[model samples]
Each structure stands twice: as C-alpha cells, then as structure tokens.
Target: MDFKELLKELKGNLLSLMGSKFDELKDESKKDVQAFLNASKEKLERWTTLLAEGNITVSDYKWLVESQKDLVVLKGLYAAGVSKIKLGHLKNSILDTVIETAIGFVKPNKDDDNEATV
Candidate 1:
C-alpha cells in the first residue's frame, strides 16, 4: 500500500485502540478512572506535540504502532498481576469489539482519487 493508505490504517488502528482503552476506563473505579485520565491527558499532549512538529518518520510510525500494542499487553498483564483488584471484564470485552469495528472502517474508497496528481 501507499503511504496514504498506510496512514489511514494506522489512524484507524490508533482510534480503535484509544476507544477501547477509554471504554475500559469507563467501567473502572472512580479513582482509577481519574488516574488513567490524567495519565492519558499527559500522553496525548506529548503525542499531539510530536504530530504537530512532523517529527515522525515511517520507521517512527511503525515503532509507535508496535509500542501501542505492547502497552495494551502490558496493561492486561498489570491488571492480572493485581491480587485483589476488581477487573471490568465486560468493559474490556466491549473495548475489544470496538477495536474490531475500528479496523473494519479503515479501508480507502474510490472517492479518494479526487485530488490532482503531479
């Protein structure tokens, strides 16, 4: 695929991941949710700055996608590690469903060819 297609896929994947993560937070205890929100806001600020600076190369984008996946796995592990934690299984499953839906929306359509080519 071309760069634009790759970017679309990446955006879709990121959105799906973020949506699921948000859904999971929604079912968390108020204190846990608040802490996660604070952390997410900080991380989002950094991501936005990086995006605005146009500092990411293709390799960097690849690394970012992989890192996000790793983070998801880490979160699952961390949740599992807790001895007496009340996990939100239903919310977590719904988050997984959201990711699947997001992935389904990533394909490019024919109308994308409207731009003038060099």
Candidate 2:
C-alpha cells in the first residue's frame, strides 16, 4: 500500500494490540513479585536474628533442616551447640563464622598454606 495507507494500518494495529486484555497476568505477576519480596525480607530478618542472637529460634529450624541436609554432623553440632546457649548469647565471632561458612568460605588447607594453622 501507499505510505499513508501503511501508516494508518500500523497505527490501528498498535492501538488494538495495546488495548488487549491482560488484567489477570498483571495481577498475578504483582502478587508473585510481592510474595517474593516478602519472603526475601523474612529471610533477611532471620539472618539478622542469627547475627544478633546466637541461639536459634523455632523459625530457623526449617532453614537448618533444608540447608544442612548434606551436613548431618554439622547440623547436629549446631543443634547441640545452640541448645546449651541462652537466647541472645550467641557470640558475634560464631555468627560471623556461620555466615562465612554458609557462603562457601573455607579455611585454607595446611598443605596449601603452611602459615595457616588450626
């Protein structure tokens, strides 16, 4: 078609496309993002608790179960260790170590770095 006709056709298509219904998708996506953000916030709060309070609360039990699945002995150690400590008495150094360990930090092997020792 001529340039004028083509422009009119394109404009009409654009308008029709923009007008199509997507209310449900918008609402669903909003809910999904909101839920994701809320969950993230809760996780941050849990981590904060871990830092501020060495003793684990019930809310953290699920996370311990899920994240420590492969490290049964370690999980047991944490469970036992926390049990003996009163609430809010967790040492800052211990919390730092836990956070570091959870993020995959490990001590250098003695063979690799002789200067580093237990």
Candidate 3:
C-alpha cells in the first residue's frame, strides 16, 4: 500500500466532504489528517501490511481504524461553532473515509477471503 497516496486521497476526500466550504477550516482539515497520521501511522502501516498479506479480515482492519477515533478532534471546527451533532457526524464520516481510503490502497492477496487475522 502506498501510504502517501492513501493520505492524499484521505485529505482530498475530507476536503470534498466539506464541499465549497472546504476553505472554512483549512488548517483544521490539514491538522485533522495530520493528527490521525501522528497517532495511527505505525499501526496503520502494520495493519495495512497484514491486510494486504491476507493476515487480517477487512472487518478487523476497519475496527482497528475505528479505534483511533479520538485522534481527530476537529477542534477548530468545533470552536467555530459547528454543532455537537454535526461534529459527531463529521467525526464518524472522517473515520469512515480513513477506512475506505486505506482499504482502497491495499491490494489484498487473492486468497484473502476475509477469513484471516493475526
């Protein structure tokens, strides 16, 4: 898996999620992803390798991704007065994006039938 590319896609998808208002929290968008990286980088690398090597189920990978939910505070947006409900949804959405993008970059082993784990 190409981590750099995966990160790029994640940031792009995040910005897109913001639509035309993307610029509103430009630093937060960048920081959100950076925070995710700072917190999840090693784990993500290991997990992606396991995933690609057919060593873990996709569900397991997703769960592992979800475990890092605390890392993305989106504090700038929150401080900017985005509602708790909206921020909650946005947080979930960001996590979902991470899962999707990481999975997209992983070219799993052909034999991986989602029945494996380390």
Query: For this target, which candidate reaches the highest lDDT against the unseen true structure?
Result: 3
Clashes in each model (backbone N, CA, C under 3 Å)?
0, 1, 0
Residue 103, model 2, lDDT: 24
lDDT of 2 by residue, 33-55 (tens): 23322334345345534523434
Q: Lowest summed-lDDT stretch of 10 residues in model 1?
A: 109-118
**How much does candidate 3 score in TM-score?**
0.78
lDDT over C-alpha atoms for residue 50 of model 3: 89
Report the backbone clash tally of model 3. 0
- Candidate 3: tens digits of C-alpha lDDT, residues 1-118: 6767776777788677754444677776667556766777778888888877778878888888888878778777777777878878887887787777777667434345543322
Pairwise TM-score winner, candidates 1 and 2:
1
The TM-score leader among the candidates is 3
User: How high is the lDDT of residue 39 in model 1?
Assistant: 41
Model 1: per-residue Cα lDDT over 20-109, one tens digit each: 645454333333433433343344334434433445432343334334332232253245343323234533542343233222232223
Per-candidate TM equals 0.29, 0.19, 0.78
- Residue 37's lDDT in candidate 3: 69
Candidate 1 residue 63 C-alpha distance from true site, Å: 3.4
Name the 10 consecutive residues with the lowest summed lDDT in model 2.
68-77
